[model samples]
Target: MVERLRGDWPALEHVLVIGEPSWDEFITTPWEDVRDPAVLPALRPDPNDVTLLIFTSGTTGEPKGVMHTHNTMVAANDPLPERLGTTPDSVFHMASTLAHLTGFLYGARLNVQNGATCVLQDVWDPVEFVDLVERHGITCTSAATPFLHDILRVPDLAERDLSSLTRFCCMGAPIPSAVVRQARERLPGLAVLGGWGQTEEGLVTLGIPGDPEDKIVETDGHPWPNMEVRVVDREGEVVPPRTEGALQVRGPFLFVGYAERLELTRELMVPADDGRGDWFDTGDLAHLDEDGYLRITGRTKDVIIRGGENVPVAYVENVLYEHPAVEAVAVVAVPDPRLQERACACVVLKPGASGFEFAEMQAHLAEKGVAKQYWPERLEVLDELPRTPSGKIQKFQLRAQVVDGPAG
Candidate 1:
């Protein structure tokens, strides 16, 4: 993996390899060098200068390097610790890769900002997570929703002491209400908060402490301080409350731009009309309730149109997650000769579960009161859903598998 990474970027200068005995072609640093503490001076850099070059998850296409200035990075971390109740005494845990925004911003940066203790895990294991919670008194965590789901499925969960955990901020993807309910039942002391953001914009909305369960499960969350979100029509006009439209964000937490993609960045930025700064098109379909809570329905490209009727893919997937047999689900648009497009639900069943049938799927949707038009016409059970390294579902890959053949 290290060799592949090196090959991707050929601008060679110096390579530092730790823990290896020796690499003849590179500088082999000893483990002692990494472990030993050294006195270092704090060097202040320009806040407006770019400091972070993270990449998008690229669920739909090729990944792009997202540029972030020091000002944006600092601003992104400022409101998080307060909202999450993180303190100097709190112990944080992070299992996601630090390269991703969730891990880098919330796991590493937020812990530093709060001056709290953090336990980093290179790999995700639910059994290990429970043990760490007991050993380290881990009080808080911010990760993808699937991490929370896996934690709920861990065997010997009832025997573990997880009282130290309080806040679990689930981001990267929509939180299934079923998974949240399971967490509530299993970890009564833990608060499962759903959030929405991307590499382009650091956590713009998050559920706060003491929020009602409806807000915890149904809506993503309220906007963070200095972050503004609005739903606009295709013409860029603000839509009324509870109306689904493209989501836009204007905030200090927004990234500077995609590295070397200035024209693409400008194309997504909507010029300011009300004296406020320009709004960045989020490429998400969502609706805001009158209370200002954001509920993301689906990605604009992920929405399935059937017989001129739109199917909310995320909504249907959430309902399917309520099924006991379903471990993970992704609803993608399948080509249809007559309707132009149809919804096909690709699911991964829980271990040792009996086979699921199309009738059973439709029955469950009916029981959930989902509109008939929104019901997925077909169901495909796979061993597992394709996911990015950060656990976001690769729906584009799923679509290719469902429509054409298995993705290479």
Candidate 2:
């Protein structure tokens, strides 16, 4: 492996190998020797100096490298301990990859900042998660909505001792109201909170422990302290409450820019009138309630247009999730020669659940008071939804399946 690495990059001057001693002959520095206190460098960096570059999920398109500095990271983590009500005795359980922003912030940085114990899991498994919680007395954790669904599916979940888990912060996707309801009923002590954010702008909003049930399930809570969020029309004018439009955010913790992509970064942002590049166009369609809570309706590009009418994809998907048989769901825009596009509901059923059909889905929607036009015209059942590593459904893949004339 060392020879291969040297062959790929001949300019490499140093190699330090840790863990296994079998590779000691191939490297110059030993891991044990590096632990000497005298060998460490005394280095101090400015707050604005770049410290990290995180890549986006690329669910929509190509992944972009987002640049972050020491000051930006500090601003991102400063409000978390107070907001989460963490104490030194608190134990944090993390199952997401550290490469993602969610894992880096809540899973790693927040715990260190609070002087709390953080248990890291290299992979996500619901049974293992429950075991870790009981063993470590875990107080809080963050994951995508699908993790909550999988936990609810664990056959022995009800028998497990999960009393130590107090908070489950669901992020990266729009959480279904049904999933929240099931979690509350199954784990009576856990606060299942919803949140919304992106790599470009850390955590924009998150539900607190005591938020109302409807707010926790229906909307993605209020913005973090010192951050500002707004819903604006194409003309950059602020929209009225409950009016869906493009979501924009400005905060101290926003990323510096895309790595070596200045023009692309400029295209994604709206410059402030004061000449500071502060306002970031989030590319999400959302609405703010009268009380300032944000509800993410759908992405700007993810919306399904049928017969010149926009279909609220997330809204319809949330309603469908209330059905007892649905384990997971995704609504995608299918190509239609006449309507330009049509909505198709792709679903994953719970164990032993069967006999789901298009008419049944339409009837369910009707019973829920959903508009007939918004009901999905087709239904496809799959064993699982295509998901990004961060747990967001890849709607683009579903759209391709629909365009390809269904799977055999």
Candidate 3:
């Protein structure tokens, strides 16, 4: 970059670099306070002009740097709080990696946008998280279904003074209605919300404020203003409500393109004759309700989405982790015309724990309020969990075990 923009990119005003001893280090600026952790950019470009480059997780392949202009960031950040009823005083938290859009763009931006104190923790410790919330009066947090479950394990969480908490929202997994209800009852101060977003569109969908009791847990809220979402076929025409299709979103929050992968970018954003703008077809399948609420079903490529239901393989695997008798598990979908596809879960038991029953897991899921239909039909015990260097679960390796094989 220094070589490519040798003349165009002049000296920077202030640079705050986050130097992680192990993880990849990142450099960011544009703040008024110029420090190591926080940098102040020397040049003051117009908010609409400054370009922000954020990295994408790239579970599909290598990590991609996504480009976003300041105008794009502001457009995505501005209206979020009111939709979630967050305030300047609200201390936002998220366990998800900040490098990801949800944590980076939304969580970090909230601090700057509201002039609120931002808490940065390197790890997700439930005990420490609750302590920080109590210590700092954190009001809003974005997380996944598993994080909430772990927090609920804190004994008598309901009795704790979580009064400062205003918003408890999650993504990347389905939050069971029971979990949401329990959370609301446990943390009466919290307005429990289930949200859905992709790295591509910058986490734009949210559940409505004061949504119906069932709606909050059952569906990811609705689209934000100025975001045009279309459930389209290969031809790209809009589909009606309740019909699952490739979730195509074109809006201000859209990432410019995959960081350095130009070929992939071309395939993703190949525009029509009119030359309107980029339309990112988030591989995830989702549908909009009559009232415009968006609910994510499943990934378009990984597993076949039966009807409109999203059989979240990851969500189910996370649930298995909550079982005391279980050690590790991976849920994968197998092709089945009758059900579109049926799920099979592979598990590894604790050293001493044995006689792990498939029926028992079904009962466990039932008790936990996981939809019965979403339960795995077959179960296989594995020796260990396959993971990447980053410790992320490798679903592809798990998927290979079930291919051309009998269930379980």
Candidate 4:
């Protein structure tokens, strides 16, 4: 890869490879050696200069490079200190990759901003996580819902001493009610907070530390300082509380634009009717309650149309997650001749589960009082759902797999 890049760019110079052997004019050095004062870059970047180009998770489509200026990146971490309740004495831990915004902002930037210690995990392991918490006295960590679910299932979790950990800020996906209940029962000392955000905009809304169970489980939480969120209908008019609509965000923490995709970036910008500023359309369906808490419903493109009726994908998936036999569930659309698309439930069963029949799922949904039309027409059992490194489900890939078959 280095040779290819060097050949493509004639002006390429000063190659440095960390933890690799030197060969063919390439310089290799230990990772720790890069921190030496002599090897650091002397140039200081301006606040307006683009310093980071992070890519979206690509759950919806092809990943786009989101450009963030130094000022924007710094602003992204500003609200986190107060939101996560981090302090100089706190010990942070990060399992998510730093390439993503969650890890970049919380794992590295938050620790630097708060002057706290941070432990980096090379890979995610629930058992190792328990040990890390006890070993490092980790106080605060931010990761996706899947990580919290895995930690609850650790065989010796009951015996582990994890009281040192105070906060578990869940992002990238919604937290189910079942998981929240389980966490409350098992780890009473720890707070499990749900949050919502994207690669373009850093963490936006996060549940407060002492929120009630309903706020922690049902809604994604309140917006952070300097960040504003609004749910607007198709006509761009703000919707009333409890009505689902397109989610829009406006904040200083937002990225400058998509790299080399200026036209695409402009399309997402909606001029604020109240004249505060331009709001970035998040492409997510959400609703705000009377108390101003945000509840994410589903992606605009993720809605399933069955017999000309819309199926609430997130609602149905959350209902299925309540089943004792189910560990993870995702509701996706499958093409049908009569109805444009039919709802299909893709599920990963917990250990010791034989099967989750379609009849059983229908019965579970009926017991939960879900409309028959909203229930998934089919149940497809899988070993595991396809996910990004940050643990967001790849529904597009799951839909394709359900329609055709898994790639060889």
RMSD of each: 4.8, 3.4, 6.9, 4.1
Off by over 4 Å in 4: 7-12, 19-43, 273-275, 406-408
Q: Please report, as a residue range, the 10-residue window in candidate 1 with the lowest summed lDDT.
A: 35-44
Please, what is the TM-score per model? 0.90, 0.91, 0.74, 0.92
- Candidate 2 C-alpha error for residue 145, in Å: 0.7
Clashing pairs in 2: none
Give the alpha carbon lDDT tens digit for every residue of 1-408 in model 4.
878778778987666665555443344445455577665555456789999999999998799999999898888888777777778999999999999888898887888877889999989999999999999999988999999999999998999999999899999998999999999899999999999999999988999988888899899999989899999999989999999999999989888899999999999998767877789999999999998999999999899889888898899999999999999999998888999998889999999998898899989999999998898887899999999999999998988888897422
Better of 1 and 4 by lDDT: 4
Model 3: residue 296 alpha-carbon error in angstroms? 0.9
lDDT of 2 at 303: 90
Q: Estimate, for each residue in 181-268, the C-alpha lDDT of model 3 and write its tens digit.
A: 6677777667877777766667667887688876786578788888877787667777899887788878788777766688887888
Q: Candidate order by TM-score, highest to lowest? A: 4, 2, 1, 3
Q: Which candidate's TM-score is highest?
A: 4
Better of 1 and 4 by TM-score: 4
Best by lDDT: 4
Worst 10 residues of 3 by lDDT: 21-30
Residues 215-294, model 1: lDDT tens digits: 99899999999999999998889999999999999989998899999999999999997987899998999999989999
